[model samples]
Target: MSEKEQPRLASGLAQKVVDTIAPTIDRHVNIMNAHGIIIASSDAARIGTLHEGSVEAIRRNQIIRVAQADDTAGTQPGVNLPLILNERLCGAVGVTGAPHEVEPLADLIALTVQLLFTQEREHSRSARRAAEARDIISALLAGHVAADVIERTLDAHGLRAPLQLELWLPRSEQDPLLEQPALDGARTCWVGLFGAHWRLRKASDEPAADAPNANDRYLIGPAAEDAGELLAQAEAMRTLAGRPAMLPRRELEGIWNQDIAVAVARTPARSLKYLAARAQVLNQEQARTLLVVAAASSMSEAAESLHIHRNTLVQRLERIGQVTGADIRQAAESLRLQHAVYARIALDELQVF
Candidate 1:
């Protein structure tokens, strides 16, 4: 078989298998890869050594029995069985003993190794598919692919169109929600890790209630064509969720019309820069004072929370207003300042600034 198509023998697993089978047969067992290089053996010194009989067995895909008289350098009197997985030559198993006595043990070891190879191959394939799914979803969300191309790509990947898309903003990359079993439920369902969230797209027939519980804030976009509308809605929900008042909710549930309003209200480029510049100019104490004043009910409460006299709090607020061009005492301007803060946070999350 070609090298790329050869089933690999996991050395560590092969070693464990050899160790487990060696004692039962009372014979030294060696596992050799398709190249005839010993990877695992009860006799540690034999590892990395080439076995001529094992190499022949792999080449011929048949058992080879080496007699003591026929043994050459690095060759032992043993029964060497070719390891085959899915009709592909993977490796060989050798048991050192009389041919009649060790042939059965060699066969058993070969079967065990074949089974292990199959399991590892499946695990590797699944991981590869998951990564491909992530890449495709990220590209779609980023608007890198045309609608027709996306549909074709989805079909190629065994997913149908008119898919329901959900954006999961987990607390962290390692959040337990990412491990939920529901993520793997349907072959048609695709779950992928996006920049700061997990994106899930499911068939229309599949109910959204069946999705895994992320146990954190998530936005469910309406099912739409080209996934373009869903992407926009997801961004809008993210901006709204960035606001302080909405930060505590565990889930956004579904897209709302008001999300468009929030998205449209995003601070303009000039205003974003102005807010950022103002923040950059503030000292740590001034920044904290501004935050406290914006969140507090009154100047007295703000002073108490900051552990400062009311007069001192008033002076800090006035100084902050003079520098940032926003009067904290007025409700409308205070709300504007808070919105600017939220805008900065949203932009940071979106990696826009």
Candidate 2:
């Protein structure tokens, strides 16, 4: 279908692509958001339901594929396309047509996806700039920076703080549903993929305690940091923390350092709360530390949290350093240690417990 003659899909191009496939392909085809919203589908019924695998890719940023049929015969089976542009996942388009039949369209899909994702990337870049500006203005407005100066700075920059801005998404994962739904609820633009998974990034200006609060939840924020930044931002503070319980050894191996899907939420006033919230948003380790770190304001604190002696705490801190790549020798150093572990866990946002 030509661009002008295409059907307007709820998902736009995904619908167009899927519709185009209808002329040649025999099986189902779908284009979906990272959230599993069927942007378009050859079969109309596929639209609103969640595409579990796609959602997981958005969450985990991992490439995933499920077998459409037995693959012992060297068949490629169905492929869940990760609509990625510039290495960041945008959304996904799927073809139920066998891989061989669908291969030809890959280039076309890739080209269009690149174009679309270029636009999406610009959105993320803009959001980052906006967030950084807001952080500066927020810092200034409380007398640390000053409101009058804030106006002058904005005037000079030809911009204003997106007074109510933030980004958030669900915890990263391979499951269609987040282990914690509150995470998705926290995002500004909800994204799901065709075959991967769903991801949501929270808006920039949400009141604390106002994001998706289902209790027993997970959240990270501030789009400035990608996967690497989650740990890099730690700098040395162990935020607040705990250990994995009843988790499998294999699952536990990589769970301690995975970056969870996060959103940017603003505090009501640019005060200590905002600073605190920003720390949580900007430093993913602190976010995870609140959930995964070994408790310790000092050697004494660590000892109490772990039910051990201060010396033992030091020994354990050394061990934690060896195990999780966190250097917990000082208060400032604990954050890095804390964040490394925080990013590795895969969350299922839908769990009740």
Q: Candidate 1, residues 1-353: lDDT per residue as tens digits? A: 23457566789989989888898878989999989999999999989999888889989999999878453475667898988877778789888888998898888888888787778776776676677667656655665566677667666665564555555555566766564432332332236443445454655554565454545655555665655654565455455544423332232222112432264346564565565553444555775566566556777987987799999988887887888787777877765555554445444522111
lDDT of 2 by residue, 1-353 (tens): 22243222236656666666556656566666756566777779868877665665567765445556655643235555666655545566665545666645644564665666456645655565445444432333223444455445544443333222222233344434433222212332222222122222333544444443333233233342222222222211112111122121222222233332111111122332333321232233233233333333455653554456777655544554564444555555565433322232212111111
| Candidate 2: regions farther than 4 A off | 1-10, 20-27, 56-67, 70-77, 103-107, 117-353
The lDDT leader among the candidates is 1
lDDT of each: 0.64, 0.42
- Among all windows of ten consecutive residues in candidate 1, which has the lowest summed lDDT? 248-257
Q: How does each model score on TM-score?
A: 0.55, 0.28
